[model samples]
Target: MPSAYVARVVLREPVVGARTWAGFATMCTGMFIAILDIQIVATSLPTIQSALGIPPDQMSWVQTAYLTPEVLLIPLTGLLTRLITMRWLFVASVSVFTVASCGCAASGSFATLIAWRVLQGASGGTLIPAVFSAVFLLFPDERQGIATTIAGVLAVLAPTTGPVVGGWITETLSWHWLFLINVVPGTLSALGGVWLLTRDQPSGLLRELDLAALSLLAVSLACLEVGLKEAPELGWVTPITLSCLGTSMLTAVLFVRRTLAARHPVVQLTMLADRRFAVGSALSFACGVGLFGSVYLIPVFLGFVRGHSPLEIGKIMLVTGLTQLATAPLAVALERRLDATVLALLGFGLFATGSALSATQSVATDYDGMFWPQIVRGLSIMLCLLAPTRLALGHLPPEQIPDASGLFNLMRNLGGAIGLALVDTVIYGRVSGHATDLAARLASGDGEAARAVGIPQALFAAHAGEPADPATRAFVAPLIERAALAAAIDEAWILIATLTLVVILALPLVRRRAEPTLEKTP
Candidate 1:
């Protein structure tokens, strides 16, 4: 082929070559922060809540505000790409994200904090799907194996390192540093993208903005997310909760009808018709539940149940991050030669095994008890990110890849949201029941129960104004609460384990992704 013709082809699509590494890094920086921001704040929630004087009931909105907008924007990324060149969209988003981080750090009130979080999430959500789209567009098959591995590392590494870094920042310094921390890295990613990459991202022909669909999507997802977050504390029967649910459902129905009927739909829902795409999406959702669910569980169990400090919790969870990097090279190696089905099954098996080991934990479980399970999860998580990506995307026509990637990533986020809700329900529901059962036995002067809680049966005064105040039935209440929480945490672990293993049933629906053309254009 003539050199000029080759140049044109390269211009049309991102050609895999030397500069690909630099561009990938720039994009990864944006992706890492977007994803990492979720967990970094996890360890510092209490500090943030108290610092801003947030009421206990409203504290959850700090996380929910960010996550809700993030999830809402994910499915719309492909549509955005169609409107603007991807490079410009990404750069603009990183800039918006950077500005929002600063606003969050400067916030002095609960409402102010939530306003910034919504902006931050809106931009951060687009980066993940953009990176996934870049993987196929920028590289060929052999290189894609290596590129995907790198992406997997960033994806898994973000949340894994978040707790550790966030813990250190909170314990050693102040909670405000959590948001201030993003400034340097975020700026560089946005600027670096402008400098290193050739700006050739293309857009679709139709340019009309679908305001109705956009409004419906935002209202539906945001209302639903807020409702879910508040339900645990507010009680599902509360009028506020019910209203949020009702409004969300009405908006969601409108959004769906608008999407299917529109000439240029904001979302291309037709992709779900592909069997491979559908099955792959389910795998993505399940992995999201496992990945996000487990991440949520370990920290809460260690912090609330065991009463560990943020730094100590970080140290315990750091094992998962360290082990994820350790296994990346090997996972990439296996990904190269093995079928997606085989790799997915293996990853799912390891993750399930790890979750099961964790389910056996009692109130006494600690760093040592959790070490093996963390290791297994870290090793398996990379394969979870890699194989499903290929299964969902490797065979799609390149033009359709962007839209498909958006939908694929959206499922994972949805899974995380739903998984957390279900796990919360299970824990809250079980705690009261477990406490009741244990209290009944204690009330009867069960010697075993007395010994288990370190309270002497004789310490009870039997009447008000007890003599052994410190050792009275009041002391026993703490034990029952801890015991009940431990039991709830254990049950949550079992739920996640079962969810992870159930992926095996969907294995038959998948076919190994076809290797794409790796050769430079003729």
Candidate 2:
């Protein structure tokens, strides 16, 4: 393991008399709140759409609204640390997030809800980097592993359990409860943060904000996320889609160039020069893409395609969440014995395998088909994430931990955007082709058995509130049902293929390093 020289310096200064346990608790609490808010809203989208009367096409914007600001603001974390005292920045962000949660709960219109969600994302984006900085500052080298274990467990659990929490609220209460639940926790965290967190005065040089870099980063990231999100609906070749993609790419290039040239760049590109950090960051990006993409795909498969209720879908995810929770501690223990890179690669492989299994699912598949795959995925995530985070930040100077964390997280977000775009595009194309073929066959009056498996003529006549002519109903309804089933199956296959590719990519990247071990730490 690395020496505690960096850790000692940070603790002796910013943390003052704070104990390790107290610091850990505070950071964990803060991170839990931030992550919880993001996940809670995800499962409640169905209820939110019904309650708000939002159009089907516009519903995704609720998620995009939050994601846009969150990712866009992530790269600025390093700059924020220099400008404001950590304590004040954390408290202010919690306040913003808390207030926004309340606003979401009280919102009567979709527009108002989206605006509050954007504010919430912007504020919540600062929490993770700040917490990582605080944790690194409080723990010594030997205990850093334990600190990370605690934090990482929570990070994994927040998203895993989100569906369960959201489902319970939406089924028993209302969608508004999703946002309302956040207010209490956020408020409590804000109060706790102010009282417990030690204040660090800002460095005079960094206190002056760089408005130019900030604006450029915000616009560039927003454009990139927006373009990716819109590509599926608008078709990538369409003029409007091409314009958004082109503009996003241009702005991103300018942002990178400006950062490299500026006297005080918002993000330090020099960090990427470190081979370990570079590899670790790449892994993080792939993990993010696979993780978020599956999160989106799984719920859609279970609920919309399979006709499972929100509560039922949530119940299924509970098994996966519990499995991950069980595996996290084991991962921390194994990291002590194994090479971090090997462990991460193994984890990624398991995750990819799980995703492949999930992709093979069909309308007839049951919980048995999903259970083991989810457990494997949970285990893989634990192994993959715990070691890579340590590997990524372990070698950095204590003062630079915040910057490294922020940059790592930013890449993960970007990876998620790219993954979502890629998966959706593939699924869309595959579904369209399958739907067209199925329609054509049904129209040709071929394969009576296949046509009967799709839509029954009597059911279609009942839905129409009149006895449909049997031939007409058979022709139209089977085509519609077959199209829907084909689309769902196509999505599953795409998710499987994407995850398999991720595993293949990760295998070559997992290289062993002859680093010192934890017991040898000074």
Candidate 3:
């Protein structure tokens, strides 16, 4: 028989009062630092690499090590919380994450740093879903919107400000400060969690947890993360990529089947059967494509095509972050009056428009070109986050919220991983072909092509009616590569935009009613 353990897991009534709010805030703080670490390391990787004497080929693993384990651990957090209870789980996660951050800062070599990063990733992964889960568990429906806004703002804000913060820290102090900065926040969050959170004993559900299903879940996600990371460079059909992805799919199937049959599943998979949660998860995935992909794309364009430094890129990228901050109030107000599906459609529609606008970019595009697109996208962020979040978790019972939150958040991360891989594939596969085509046009004395490639029409004019000398070709080669890169990046923007637009179709399936759909386990 299926166990009644799910019903038994709600250890107390929904959290209430000022102390609970403080506890929620502390959880948010821990989550913020954890998310910030990903973006900060991305922005400061070059500096970190030089400091540690890491080879160019190996530097990327610094990030992959962090990301792979984080992905594997996120969904598992639902079960982990049952084993320890939320209060101790939050405290322990924060403490371990802080210690790992310190170890990262103190590391003297590449291997040492990666080891610390793996630990950091494992501990930090739980913080995000834990905060989102708290919003529903700690607040009434009337107040969940405002609370979601607070958590959503911080969630998105961390990534938006990470580049600027990381760049400033590395330039003024040192790359070590990137990790060190997490210490103060982590310490306070850990202490606050212990003091403010309601104490509850674990349900002692470990005996009921399915170890085989747990292993399958971990292996599936780990393999999936690895496959996505390698697919862009190695080609999706290559043996290693195929093996990893195939194994991920196979294990995922077995895991889902095993969990569905288990008396007490490790992580709740039945939540996805609810229409609201299911549709909301899909929308969340789409938002991830836009949110994380744009963050990744903008920095690459600014650094490589525009020849900007990390600080300059960060400053330029501030438009999106600032606009998001300015729009949060309006989004919260609107969430109260509108149906969630309506709000979600509006949010995703505007996001799609913004992404489409960005797809028209040229090599010379800068903050001026990006400003309006950033504003449109910024306007959509909170709308995209708040509504889908409420739709996904709002109707679930307090006990189910934790597991559902983990699954919902997992969809977004998976979307980000896949979106980034596709973006990389587009850039790498197209740049060479685009460069070749532009070179051909230049050779044919096309002034329009000359202008598009950032070469002076006069340069082409000087070589008019004659084969250009090797010197001229060499000079123009770099310009052709730059223009090619810009074109490739634009295509990537369109790909994400299309993805965002496509998910909007599923909104109708979300049902107009907001009542809880699951049979309460008893």
Candidate 4:
């Protein structure tokens, strides 16, 4: 009995009190800025493209460069934390991120900018899992709710407010400031992390690092990220997309097999065998689909369909961010009192409804039309993040938390990647068909089609009563494309909502947390 109890005991005790909280907050801030950089740069890509004289075709590489390394490095953070203590790992990451930000600001060309972005992303990738792992390592189980709330707020909030922040920065200060803004925050976080964090001795795990597995992981994630990025534009079945995805799959299989057979795997895939963690991971993925999909959707609609500038779009999108801020406390409080599964169900249900509500939007829908759906989604955001987070990482022993956090967060990111691709696929695939159908209807004197094409009734009568002149068709072409885009975006909304709802079906399979039989010894 004593031997069994010894085996179950936490190897490291949770750090307590004010200093640890400050240390945890420092890590969270680092994470926030890292995540914020992604959105800030994303929203202002056009400005950057124009300033750098990058061709439109090549502009997306700026983001793709950052995202690929980010995705690849995220799952490796556990191994990194083991090799270097969390404090040093965070400080090093922040330093690299800060310096890379400077490089980004000084870049004279697209190639230079993308090179710096890759470094920025590689370092930034560790910040998220580091903070999450800190939650479990730094706080006792009872206090984890509040800790997670803090991290969760920033985690969700960065992306929520990123567009607005990016838009404002580009409009007022220029795109350079987007990367420059991280300097002070990143530096301070690093310094504070060094001062406040309790140091843990390294496990001398460096010698055991498996280079082959590392190489495989790098190839798999890089290919997968590039594949997903290009799949939307080039079509999923194209040679480029297929080759990248196929390589990712084949390498991923080898990596998994190698990991499972190894005594000390880089990432702990065996965690999936735990029913609660597995279900929680699935829920996390669904939440990602909604979170990232909506962020991408709203901006595209405002910018393309409504012809809103980035600044104006950001202002309109503030509805979601402000609502999230207002409801955050309520969410944190409920997380403490509510059943994790029940809270997750409620959150997902609201998210699905919110997504579905947005699908009802038309070409003419604007801020007033989008307000309530954003509100509902904002209200549910914290709930979605907090509940599944607790379900996934809450019950795990301290030693396992780092690897578990990496895997759990990886699922969310993967969901986001796949979801965005699907959204793009829907919009790009169906827009032309919608335009053709609308054109035929307009030719048949359909009033609704005329309205969608924005043709005046008198003008529509002229066009429909006779073969339209080239001048008239030319005038109507842009309007037809706009209406078709709006229709396509609506279908994409329904796709994400359905995905979120479908995740709920697996909730029943997760077992409830078993009651504790032994108190954790200090």
Candidate 5:
């Protein structure tokens, strides 16, 4: 109902044209498969490892390989968009992704599958941000809300449904079908998409690649991502990790200098000079942290501590997707009429509240107990996703949109990388400290510890390391670890809550969109 009213109020004509919808549909299909692939692979990693004889330790690289390039390529989207044009870029990315999917499905070796995944990730990363550009470029302002809302839901829904979808394929068919399933949709998304959006306008004329900048950028992000991923397992200060960190710093500094001096930089660092864009990009980073970090925390908590199956956790997580689906239409409807900054304030506040509430969780917290926080986060994330784009590019000039889009989107991924690292530090670093403290407190038959874990003095005296029943050993160890873990997670949740509240300082940077200055040049 509000969509109609907002359309009427904002537009003199119908905004959702046939071509517009067709273009948007193509984008949605591509993005869905892209996102869904990530989650599916995650759930099916064990099977994949078994199939390819991948070492348990190296199996994580399957994901790391994909994400490193994805993160690297994301910042260079504007350059790519300018180099090949949006039409061809979209087609090529989808095509390569499809081909990579085929390669992964047919892969006979661990190395081969990882190679294909890297290709898939590079291609897929392009489409994820492109979806947003399409929302602004393919549609008019009045209709952007609806388009963005739909696309946002697809992105959010993929994570929610991934475990279920991955579980189903593994149980019913086989893991190969997970990759194979993408072939049809990805093909259509590529071929049909190009044919539908046949028109093109030159955005960037920079024909040459900034090789130095590209190299530094690639190394910097690759190191940063890999370093963060490895930090929890291998101590952060370990030699290899320190080298990665140091290398990332060096390359990052060089990349910034190189890009600043270059005539046609791969990433438009200048875009951040705009006050609104800078603030918006920062907010996007925070949003990325919220989105990816929360997703990481939930599955981890449920799997490691709560002992819930992936399927059950997936069902619990579906509440977020459902809540997002329910609220998206209204958020999109308000996007045009409401000041983006105001909506952002409301979003950050609710998100902070939800994160704070979750911090109070105990070992007993379950699906229903966490339900309201899911709803709060779900509703807030829509605003988080939608508002940053509006705040950043909504006010920029026509020619600045593509570069700004790339920069804006990059912040989100960077946030995820940095946020996950922080989460790990909290869990790995804090849990050990908490465990030591907890052990000391429980040393002399502590009453509170007794009441909390339900272990009597006699059981507490039993050494966990002794030869014991498998069931008893598992139970006792987890009981001790869970106590320490619960405290650590609560502390991490509080940290996340504090971070969300910190977004308020950036709210003032988001000015009202200049309606007349807004251009339709996508």
Candidate 6:
């Protein structure tokens, strides 16, 4: 068995005499609120777009607005930890997010809402990793396994519950309710953060902030995130796209150089050299891709292709979320007896398998077919997330825990951005390719025509929603049928390829160490 080691050292000094569940609960509540806000806006997007008259092309920015600040701020977390007391930061972040939520609700234009979301994300970005560090530091070494388990469960659950909450608010009330709903939790968390969290000021020259690096870091990440988000809509080779990309790359290079030269760097570049940390961050990146890609894809499939309501998607996701919650303890328990590396590998395998299975979905597939994949995927994530985290920080000195956690979380967030972009690009390309190919076949005077392929002319006729004489119907019917089938196949193949890549990248990171049995704590 690996020796029990202090995973975190509280530099600020612990105010509470001993760790209690209440303390953990309070810490997690802050994290829960932060993550909940991240996802709650997702299901409400269509409603927001319609009510605000947002262009379809600009609709994605609502999400990007939040994600951009969040990703950009993640690396800065370690620096923030040194610069400010955790208690003050937590309270400030919660307050910012709450106010931003209100701003989002009250916004009259797309630009205003996007601005609020950026503020919300920037504040939220600091809160999450800080909370994780707090939890690790609050608990003793012996209880870390349990603490990690609890933390993992909350992380998974917040996002899982988001769709359901967002859907309910969007369907039953105005989309504004999605933002307004956060007010209560946000207020409570802010108050709780101030009351429950102890404060201590860090000493020495490290307390001084690096203004140059901070500015460069923010500009670099903002440009990069905006570039990635806009690249799909703006032609990649366009002057604007090239400008954004160039600016992002240049700023990023400067940020890195500035950090290395700074007396107290905003982000510690040295900690990344730790093999466990490096490997874990890489795995987290891949996991982020699979996680966020599915989060985006599943609802799109259900609502657009299957014609399900937001409420129905929420209901299905609720089931999947609950299953993940239920499996958290089991996964944690299993981790004790297994090497974290091995567990992560197994988890990723299950996730890839689940994605592969989901790729086989069709218009005729029902809830039953969908439920199993979600269940497997949920269990897989529980195993995958915690193990990589454990493996990454396991060998690090306690003082470095916060730095490692921040970087690990940052990579995952960046991975989500990259994954979503990649998947969307692939699906769009494939769909267009398939559509063009299928259109050609339909136009060809071949024996295996649309009629020969067993597609009903009426189905395509209904899709056009136009009354057609037999001549018009015959000409248009085959094209519509071919297009639908091609789109479906294109989507499936893209997901298949995505999952395959995830498995391929993840395989090497699995640990070759012998499994150790976890002992129960009293």
Q: What's the CA RMSD of model 5 in angstroms?
A: 5.2
Order of candidates by lDDT, top first? 4, 3, 1, 5, 2, 6
* Alpha-carbon TM-score of each model against the true structure: 0.91, 0.87, 0.95, 0.96, 0.90, 0.85
User: By lDDT, is 3 or 6 better?
Assistant: 3
Tens digit per residue, CA lDDT, model 1, 1-522: 466545545534555666777987898889999888988886788899889898987787788889998989999888888777678878988999999999999999989999999999999999999888888877776777788888878887788778889988987898888998899999999998887655765666655668889899889988988888777667778999899989999999999989889988888888888878887788899999998899889888898778898778878888998898888899989998788888889998899999999988777788999999999988899888887888888767666777898999999988888888878988888999888877776776566655554455565324323333455557678888887887888898899889988987898987554534445664
Which residue pairs show collisions in model 1?
none
What do the candidate models score in CA lDDT, each in turn?
Answer: 0.83, 0.73, 0.89, 0.90, 0.81, 0.72
lDDT of 4 at 271: 97
- The weakest ten consecutive residues by lDDT in model 6 span 5-14
With a 3 Å backbone cut-off (N, CA, C), the pairs that clash in candidate 3 are none
**Any runs in candidate 1 off by more than 4 Å, and if so which?**
1-14, 444-470, 511-522
lDDT of 2 by residue, 95-146 (tens): 8988998998999999999999999899988887677666566666555666
Q: Number of clashing residue pairs in every model?
A: 0, 2, 0, 0, 0, 0
What is the per-residue lDDT of model 5 for residues 220-339, given as tens digits with 9 covering 90 to 100? 999999998998879889998999999999999999998899987888898778888888888888887887778878887887778887777788888888998898878987787788
Model 3: weakest 10-residue lDDT segment is 1-10
> Whole-model lDDT, candidate 4?
0.90
> For residues 1-522, what per-residue lDDT tens digits would candidate 3 score against the true structure?
223434533432454788988999999999999999999899999999999999998999999999988887788777887889888989999999999999999999999999999999999988888888888877877778888999999999999898899889988998889999999999999999989987877864667877788889888998998898899998999999999999999999999999998878887888888999999999889988889999999999999999898889889888988899998999999999999999999999999999999998888899899999999999999999988898898777777888888899989899899999999999989999999999998888888888889977776788766877788778988999999999999999999989999999999888788333455655
Rank ordering of all candidates by TM-score, starting from the highest = 4, 3, 1, 5, 2, 6
Per-residue lDDT of 416 in model 3: 93
Model 4, range 1-522, lDDT digits (tens) per residue? 355555544443564889998899899999999999998899999899999999999988999899889888888888888899888999999989999999999999998999999999999998998998998888877788888888988988898788889989988897899999999999999899999998898864787888899899999999998998899889999999999999999999999999999888989999999988999999999988999999999999999999998778888888888888899889988998888899999999999999999998777899999999999998998899998899999888877888898899999999999999999999989999999999999878898888776778786776566877898789989999999999999999999999999999988987877665765566
lDDT of 6 by residue, 23-42 (tens): 55666776787788778788
